[model samples]
Target: MSFRDRTHAGRELALRLVERAGSGHLIDVLVLALPPGGVPVAAEVAGALHAPLDVLVAGEISTPVRPETAIGALVADDPPLYDRRSLAMMHLSEDRLGDVVVGERNELHRREYLYRGRRPLPSVNGRTVVLVDDGLTTGLTATAALRFLRRHGPTRLVLAIPVGNARTLSSLRDECDALVCLQQPPSLHAVGEWYEDFAPVSDTQVADTLHAFHATA
Candidate 1:
């Protein structure tokens, strides 16, 4: 199934989570989005669940040749998570990606600071943390974000996405308490293929989304 856009996909995703919440699967919920693509999608979720919306900046590491590829992902100051198979196939090593990691890490920090000024990440201990993203391709970034959240002592961690690759979604099942994916095609060539409007989300859009949420919250 294709989505009209991120907003439409978000509303649809929220319906599934609301069912989970109704079943008592969610408690003391806190919605954390992986910006900037995840912001608008998550805004709908945070509103539906009456949960606070926030951002958890995670950066994708890729080589200059294939910039769209995600060889690894990093969150906060934690160690980067790499796809070993992908690395081996590409004949690349973590050491070789040092410069890429540094660049992505810097961008991650810049995004975090831009979306959230001096404010620190909200506490996840004993709370049900829902990490929202637009969609998952390799799922490296979501995996990295989930691992980072896992260390923070959350009571339950959930990963929600509108669409993703079936195999990739299955691989991430162990990372969170629950996984909500609307469309899991046999093979996902590109995430944009499943969305009618897959435009790049700007930094200004991310900032404005958070600002609007906080204003009401």
Candidate 2:
């Protein structure tokens, strides 16, 4: 299965959500997207559900030795959440990741500012929170976002992605109240592989999505 674009995938996922929500799946939900890719998808979802849309900035921390591989994830202002498996594989430790964490944290904060401006993060307390991402591979960023959001006391924590690796989808099922994934291909590597037009999403695109959401909200 493949998507024409993020907008198309979002529309498809929104239909699934509507069906699921009718069967006691989602209620009083607040859509929180992992930008810059998730914004367009979540925008469609928020429009369909008539829910408020916001961003939960999450980023991967890559090691200097292997810049392409993510060793951990950075969410909010909390300490970076290390992928223990990845750490052990690279013969690394938490303390050794300090520099990488610092860099990723700075980058994540810069994005948070760029996307949301001076507006504070919306409250997820006592509400059903839907965490939307374009897709998942390692799921490290999703885990970090989930962990960080857990501190806010949401009534229910949901993971809603259009597609993901089969293994990752299996492991993540137990991590949240509901996991709404449209496709879980058994042999997957990158999220872009499942999309026909997986062009890079720019920072301006993300900001515009949020601006559009708030304009009619």
TM-score of each: 0.97, 0.96
Highest lDDT model number: 1
lDDT tens digits by residue: candidate 1, 140-215 = 9999999999999999999999999999999999999999999999899898999999999999999999999889
Clashes of each: 0, 0
Cα error, candidate 2, residue 191 (Å): 0.8
Error of 1 at 10 (Å): 0.5
RMSD of 1: 0.9
The regions of model 1 sitting more than 4 angstroms off are none
Model 2 deviation from the true structure expressed as Cα RMSD, one decimal place: 1.1
lDDT of 2 by residue, 8-84 (tens): 99999999988877888788989999998999899889989889999999989887789988878889888887888
RMSD of each: 0.9, 1.1
Model 1's lDDT to the true fold? Answer: 0.94
**Candidate 1 TM-score, true structure as reference:** 0.97
| Residue 155 lDDT, candidate 2, scale 0-100 | 94
lDDT against the true structure, each candidate = 0.94, 0.90
